[model samples]
Target chain A: MNKNLYIKELKRNRKNFFVWLSIVFGFTLLVLSIFPYMSGMGEGLTALMEQIPPEIGKAMGMDEQTWSSALGFYSTYYGVYIVVLISIYTASTGAGIISKEERDRTSEFLLTRPVSRKTVFWTKIAALFSLTLIFFGLQTVLAGIGLSLVNEGTMDWGIFTRMHASGFILICFFTAIGVLISMFFTPKKNFMGMVVGLTFGTYFLNAIAKSTEATKWIGYISPFNYMEITIDPHHAFNYWGAIVLILVAIILLIVALKSYEKRDMAG
Target chain B: MLAIETINLSKLYGENRGIRNVNLKVERGEVFGFIGPNGAGKSTTIRTLLGLIHPSGGRATILGHDIVSEGVELRKKIGYLPSEVHYYDEMNSRELLEYSIGFYDNINPDEIEHLADFFELDLAKNIADLSFGNKKKCAIIQAVLHRPELLILDEPTSGLDPLMQNRFFDLLEEKHKEGTTIFFSSHILSEIQRMCDRAAVIRDGEISAIENIQDLLKKQMKKVRIVFNPDAINRNLPIGSQNEKWHDQKVNFEYVGPIESLIQWMNESKVVDVVMEEPDLETIFMNYYKR
Candidate 1:
């Protein structure tokens, strides 16, 4: 990877990184910080939970445990908001990282430099995932801190670890899809709408599948179905699913690199 | 080794457009011009050499490096100035220039300041805020920053005023003295006439002619009008003069011969006044295009 290009990519993205990071950070804290109040309501919240349909509760990834424990409460929001939001940020960034150069018509300046297209491709990828890992890591760390701060009872570290592990895999899977999608589309296209649709669309697919027995097969098409965010002690981390999703991500990235190498630098 | 050599280089976009079967050999330290109208495939050929677009067929080498397989190494010695400058709008001129030079080694950072000052460009202004001419100045600075061996310029003076154009040509002269091989592409005949040693004329994606500038000028037809003394009106018109017309003692015709012969012929006649005009390149191009 070219260090000069990698550093420039990182510096160029610094401001956008902060904006997304703050949003994810604030959302993580907000979910965790509000848990104590919900748990304190006790039977009143339980009564409120009973009034909602189980299918609706399942669709939202909520349950009785959502009002009982910090991890359970946070897991509901983690899957829907934190993971999807972070994925949207990362996936949109991945989509734009290389395509933006062409869209801005700076590829001529860049490709004319003493750097191979391969070096530029991988260097941008390296910078991209570096941002991805950092963003994922910081959010995980914040969640851990928030969980510890609010929980009056002992937190289940194993379930927390399992849930976040699946979240990381899902985030990577979506980010890779973002990169691949950008390769097929015109450089001038704004990827935000597509990225939002992808992240939310798949998340809903999994939610819909879980809520109804009839549509469970539909979830198989989505990556979210493979790596699910669950606070249940009975459900273990899907190691095979994680591996498959990681491999798919690698394949997507390689496909993106190949297409980029062959693409004409359009002004 | 030749500075650039292309063997049957072709890039066809669908059935129409793009260069075809272009073969050229540019010697080291030669100032070669590539003249064609817009959409005449000049930029297409240059982009092929730079490896911006994959060649449809054939191959080329620059500084003895294969354009396809060894583009990175070859580009190290190439300085390209595009017709339309597009830089990162977020960066000021100084930052953009610095970023550009960071890709190459053995660069003098002081050269950036020197070139910027020479072009009278303010380095602190963001690229988005700069005028088209200012951005062009920035483009020129970056192209020559590393003292590259080959300079490829495409319509390089479009946005610059005449004064900057002169300064730019002066700088190019300095670079040429240092043995830089320049591939200047433009539709402007005057610029090519001023700077080129030899030029290749491309039309409809094919090379119609490649001639030494002096030879082209010599072979071109010049419109001549001569007013003779009434007593000298009986003298014979010079050979090689065509389409002659007369109005009393004044005669007008097109001449396509050595200037010395035309002058000698004029010496034989007691002439009162003479007017000669060389047709512009567009007319010359039309002559080639017609055939």
Candidate 2:
């Protein structure tokens, strides 16, 4: 869709966008710096796990762990927080992409230009993608930098990259959902609020249902559960399930685009 | 081919109707005015023509392209200013114009610069920092600098002061002289009277009348004056009745149709003076709703 047009729109509204990215990356940097300290707690927690029921360990994906390394810290502790943060941040970004124009009443002016609605939609999506990647990459780099200076270079880059990969996947997945919501729903603020509520509620339901063997599959229903947080890439990153979710989410996004193409803008 | 034509167009939002059964033809270079009061659906008709809203029942064409089916192509030749301008808050005037011009393939940067200078709009000021009128001027420049063939303005001077509003009208006149079909919606009859050669008054999602400004004035209407003489009243004049009494003089009113009945009623030797005023757009506008 027009890259120049997308860049122009972002450049026109760069202040808020800059603020949004700064918050995302600043929070990411803060969280990354503290995660190592939190890993010390993970070590203590793993020791405590030894005294708990084995069922608890099996259920939280903490059945096996080195406890002190980044991988273990990520597996048993950081995954939940990371997924939650990614979902919220990405959804906010996506919702802002379309709904912000409506909120500001600028969509009528913007869409009246010579571009097609599909082009405008894709341009916004591209701008959001670029913004998301820039912050995600910066946070990842700062995490690496923080690790080098503070951790005596003992940090696990593989675990770090894998975690980011999962985070990125989750972000894109939610972005697609956000686009769908933008396309289908009226420019009502409550829709974003509802989506945020559902994201957290789904995770809670999945975690609560995992105790039963028949209900274990409910965890797979949430994108958060599909990212695999067991400290073993082979066991944790459920490749087949993630691919399935991604494909399904992508298909849903296509439907959203089609709906946008057919529906009249709320002019 | 005409610049814009709506073929029996109509739109309805559920049971709440917008402009219904609207049929309009604008030639290649004519300023067609759309006049209506509040909730008159003037904006609705403009939005449907701009492809911002779909025609629930009929169709509109812009420069030979169907607005609904060929919107992208049709929009390329159209410039529009919404009733309430909404712009990117962070963009200064120049940044907004540059960003807007980047979308069109045939834009000339120098023309935009000239328009900005002509409108006395500072390009370096951010839109949010500018006053609402200045922001509207920015929107107008962005809409017109590309020199679109059809200009559909919805309340184009909603925020501007009279001086700037006149300047905008001058700009519109220049565009019209250059063969741009000018179409705009307004509730202010005085402004519409000034800007348009032919205006259609819409009332309650319907076009009440389409007529030339001069034609509306020619229709015989009430003309009244207070005279100092009560006994000089011409009883033979079969027209207006006495309005009120001023001191001892009875205010005589009568039909002045064809300007002859009043002339025949007045005796040049007896009348002290004469004061004649024509019908204004306000009276014509009220008469529109009364029908």
Q: Tell me, what's the RMSD of every candidate? A: 1.6, 3.7
Candidate 2 global lDDT: 0.73
The backbone clash count of each candidate, in order, is: 0, 2
Worst 10 residues of 1 chain A by lDDT: A227-236
Off by over 4 Å in 1: B258-264, B273-282
Q: What share of the true interface contacts does each candidate keep?
A: 0.77, 0.79
What tens-digit string does per-residue lDDT give for candidate 1 at B1-291? 999999999999988888899999899999999988778899999999999999999999999999999999999999999999999999999999999999999899999989988999999999999999999999999999988999999999999999999999999999999999999999998898888899898888988888888777768999999999987684477888999999999999999888899999988779999999987766776676676
Q: Any residue pairs clashing in model 2, and if so which? A: A228-A236, B92-B126
